[model samples]
Target: MRDLTKGGKDRTIFIGKSLMTFLKGHFERYQEIKKQLGHEFNPNDLIFFNSRGDYLKLRELHRAYKNAIKRAGLKNARFHDLRHSHASILLKKNVHPKVVSEQLGHAKSSITLEIYSHVAPSLQEDAAHAFDEE
Candidate 1:
């Protein structure tokens, strides 16, 4: 995947089947829009773009995210919170920190551990109980 973050380093991230289906639907919509434009569509256009095939500005995307959060009645949520939420869910499900770090495009697993260590206590407790059972 393209690295749109400050690091500017490209990394691969796996998406779930549901996300793949969503992306396929999104691309199909884009193709339909392109067909409607009648010879105005660039084949090399970005996946996420405006009607004119221009990439969305960061501010525009942020505003949309904010609006969505507000509509969902979520308080104090930012777009970046989605990343943290994903990491937290994966960690809680017993995914390895290294895998999470790679998905997050962090420079190291230690960075993922550092940022999400708060989720670890419960996991540790679960491990202790499982060990006792064994």
Candidate 2:
């Protein structure tokens, strides 16, 4: 069982159009698979399942993520880094820090800044130019 303190938090992530379409198709297929399973299915089904159609374990998810990066020839990093990347991308676009922190499930903006400050270019811009004499 997941520790409620760690796993019970809710966060919202933006869905791109392509990802939405993909999720729609995935759920359609999921429904079909559920029908094939008939009454054997449980009500608490998982979004991602193992080959035996059981809920996926976290270790399985981590293993697959590691292998995917290896196959793609990318530098390996913790999956947590992806959350930072997403926040950084949003912050770079001048999206609000509170919004980004919420999306990243951070308790505060300080935590977001601590984790993703390097990726946030907002701090690097020279606002001094706004009132410079010609």
Over 4 Å off, model 1: 1-9
Q: For residues 24-88, could you state the per-residue lDDT of candidate 2 as single tens digits? A: 99889888988998646645777778766777789998999999989999899899877767787
Please give, for residues 1-134, the per-residue lDDT of candidate 1 as tens digits.
55476687667778899999999999899888888886557556788875567778898888888999989898978778999999999999999889999998888999999999999898899899989998
Task: State the weakest 10-residue window (summed lDDT) of model 2.
Answer: 125-134
Q: How many steric clashes between backbone atoms does each model show? A: 0, 0
Q: Residue 119 lDDT in model 1?
A: 97
The lDDT, on a scale of 0 to 1, for candidate 1 is 0.86
Which candidate has the highest lDDT of all? 1
Per-model C-alpha lDDT, please? Answer: 0.86, 0.75
Can you list the residue pairs that collide in candidate 2?
Answer: none
lDDT of 2 at 42: 40
Give the C-alpha lDDT of model 2: 0.75
lDDT (C-alpha) at residue 21 in model 1: 100
